[model samples]
Target: MKKIVLIIALLSPLFTYAQNKPNKKKGPTTYDLLIGTYTSGTSKGIAVYRFYAENGRLAYLSQIDGVTNPSYLTLSSNNKFIYAVNETPKGEVSSFSFEPKTGKISFINKQSSEGDDPCYVGVDKAQKNVFVANYSSGTVAVLPVNKDGSLSKAIQTLHDDGAHGPNKDRQEGPHAHMSILSPDEKYLLYNDLGTDKVNVLRYRASNEKPLEPASTPFVSVKPGDGPRHLEFSADKKHAYLITEMGSNVLVFDYDNGKLKQKQTITLLADNFKGQTAGAALHLSPDGRFLYASNRLETNEIIVYAVNQETGELTFVQRQPSMGKNPRDFAIDPTGKFMIVANQNSDTIYVLRIDNATGKLSPTGSRLEIGNPVCLKFAPAQ
Candidate 1:
């Protein structure tokens, strides 16, 4: 009995140790890449991919179909819901319930955008209001978000119709390009590319009609600038507006829903000037760098060093996007990798970002997708 007990005691510790051993062969860290595409071509709907960060590789997972022309996508604050613009003449905004564990999304419901050819969708910081920008109709729609992640009918549609910009062809009428909320969520700013103005709307999430024109209704940029997108500095004191037609970045001093132009800089080199249109602007997670994408002839990313105190930009380096007509790009959560969605080339290029110098180097990894217009990332489960 004593011998048997000794053997059992020795084996029990070994068994416990074996059961409690740490997993040395750890699984690769992965992220969910949600791609929004123009469904006019081969793309049916939103495409999802599993991005292996360690190797800079992407594996196709699944796609959410049935929603047409989901060219832009945004997520709820809790990461429980996703919203996309239907980008049709009869515009709509669709909602989906996100499954983090499986990296799958289920359609919830869609609501009328109250305007034509909706191009951008964004959720306010409070997550109680959803906003959409209609390009063709030159209107901004505000809808209330239900607790269950569904959207109510638009409560207000603000239209901007007035004198057109200098570009007679593209700016004949009001063309609302993007709607973005101030960092504090106290104000909503919509960029009107056709009107050459940025409209500021006072927002109160708790109100029945959450949007009202601010004291200063709109701020006019250069006549032909055609501001398409705006990004706020981390301090909320500076705003950067990227002009689509002019291919320039405008810096503004922001305070209490007013924007004063501070400086304007061109996105291309001084000597080499080919056709270039600014497509997108993004500030790095750390606020040290600002990146702007140029489509048309340039097809490159212009990097600028951000002055931490002044919020001014110093031109850094421009890197070829490795594909044609780069429409949008996103920086990974870790700030280590950036993925560019080239709309014309039908390819997604992965590039490594140098944290110190704000330089981008290609990872030689690319994924082929049709008409990819936007790239968004969510943390893996």
Candidate 2:
């Protein structure tokens, strides 16, 4: 019967279509890891690695040698260039052009940081300026970015004049520790470790000197808090600060260039008391959780459940860094693994991330490097 044949042909075509449709395309399985170090020990300079996403492993690729203390690093928005702080008494900033495909970097140029012991470096999205935080001199310098990805001399330097904190030894003078761009890239916030203040500055990418003090000059924390680093929420409505001396995470409601403290939480346990020093804090990729690293006696990653509505944090669980003095950690682009750098132990460890519970478990993967303090992840290209 012709009618029966037509039905069979239609059903056959439908079955073929269903069978030919390919399975869901998989995501990227590899990324590039950039490690910044103190460079005083075995590390030659900045090191690069190829990271396997599926199994959370790392393979060393190449490194730039003979550069002095490339301690803190920041990449341009396009990932085409990188800037690092020399972190010496006569501080300097170095520039390099990066090739995302081959994990190779070429030195471009270097410039004076305009102060002593520059510790942190940041670059604007448009590559117009590179900012440096000078710790010992307590100053912030803005250097113009050359068209060829090099750095020009600092155009502006602002000295921190805030009063010192109560700690006599550590807070003898102002010490600028870090400078971070806001989520929207509209403001620059830096912390003074010796002044106990988080200073916010308005940013304009096109200007020769791109930073200006915000309406609210600085937000004062407890005298001995020693704010070290600050991380803002993905939505730009909240901010979190970790103190180096006091070892507390402070929550704040962030608005147009202003911060209002809301809640403060301690990173140390009640019974275990030795020493406390908070280093770095970061919000998870999905913005559902916050992770902070505590150095000194407690070498652990403290997790917290972020309250989306109220911009507050509830304690999650603590995971050991599996090494000594965890300085900084980076979550892979896929958000499946965490890479932690142990400056004292000279080891880097990878941990598996639980998407559901905001917890971390050791992946048993480790890389041995000397004085690894910072870890950053980018696409392998």
Candidate 3:
């Protein structure tokens, strides 16, 4: 009996030690993904998903319906509200209160976009103003965001009238594609694809008519380049413009709301002659790399090594987007993965980004939704 008792006592400590061992498996770090889609098809409205940053996987969550073509989405600085553009003949901008914990959203109130077919939406850093680019109407409207996160009536509307681009079918008139706020929130810049120019305006929250033309009102690109999107470097010293018609990226030196052309690079191979359209442009969090996506023919992402000192770009590698017609894509806050919204393919592809070389590799995970047009990530609550 003594021998058996001694043996049991020795094993008890071992059993306790095994029971107290730390877990080797770690829980996933999650982020809230908001997808904007075209409502012409089966898609009702914005779809929400939970993205597992640890492994580049997404779990579908609930969605908010009844919105017509919430084609583009932007989140408030506080991450407590979301704003979307109702792309319709009679355009509208809707606001919603976002619950990150539950991945659910509740409709607040919507206001007229002051134009037709609004395509893009952006919120100021102060969260006091919301901006919409009316693509069909060739106007940009500034709407005040109420304290409760709803949108008030548009306070000011700026009409852009200019010479049309060379492409008569697509660029017959001013088509404002995107409206973005400068890093300091002191200026607003918008691209007019039809006019092939970027309009810069000074923004003041306290003023009655907040948006005024900047000293350098506009920067004109090549006649038919069709500047679609603009992305500023982390230092705010450089800007990159993605041209839809030409399928190229243009580099610019930015200073005090003025842009000077630096360089232009093609997004395709020298010998590959096919229809190409540049869609989206994004810079890595570290500002070491730049990524731009080409739709239609190529359906690939053009990677570039950014010269931090001079803001010049050197071609890196082009990787397939893994789906068709990548209209928009976003890099997660951690910069570990990129999610591409393939509008025509009805899918979203997850690609792992190599931090060392800025190259992309497929993670083999995809989300199926009807005509996913825009992707936005909010930190998990």
Clashes of each: 0, 0, 0
Kindly indicate the candidate among 1 and 2 with the higher lDDT.
Answer: 1
Residue-by-residue lDDT tens digits, candidate 1, 6-84: 9999899999999999878754368889999998888899988988777678888889988899999998878789999
lDDT of each: 0.91, 0.90, 0.93
| Cα lDDT tens digits for candidate 2, 1-381 | 999999999899889988898666756778889999998899989999999988898998889998789889989989899899998999999999998788998999999999999999998888888989999998999899989999989888987775788999999888999988887888889899989999899988777677889888899999999999888888889999999998899999999889999999988877877987899898888989899999888999999999999889999999999999999999987888999999999999999999898899998999999999878787888
Q: Model 3 off-target regions past 4 Å?
A: 1-28
TM-score of model 3 relative to the true fold? Answer: 0.92
Superposed by TM-score, candidate 3 places the C-alpha of residue 165 at a distance from the truth, in angstroms, of 1.8
Between candidates 1 and 3, the lDDT winner? 3
Residue 309 lDDT in candidate 1: 86
Kindly list the per-residue Cα lDDT of model 3 for residues 131-225, writing each as its tens digit: 99999988999999989999999999998766688889999999999999888888999999999999999998999999999999999999988
**Candidate 3 displacement at residue 374 in angstroms:** 0.3
Provide C-alpha RMSD values for all models, in order: 6.1, 2.5, 6.1
Off by over 4 Å in 2: 1-27
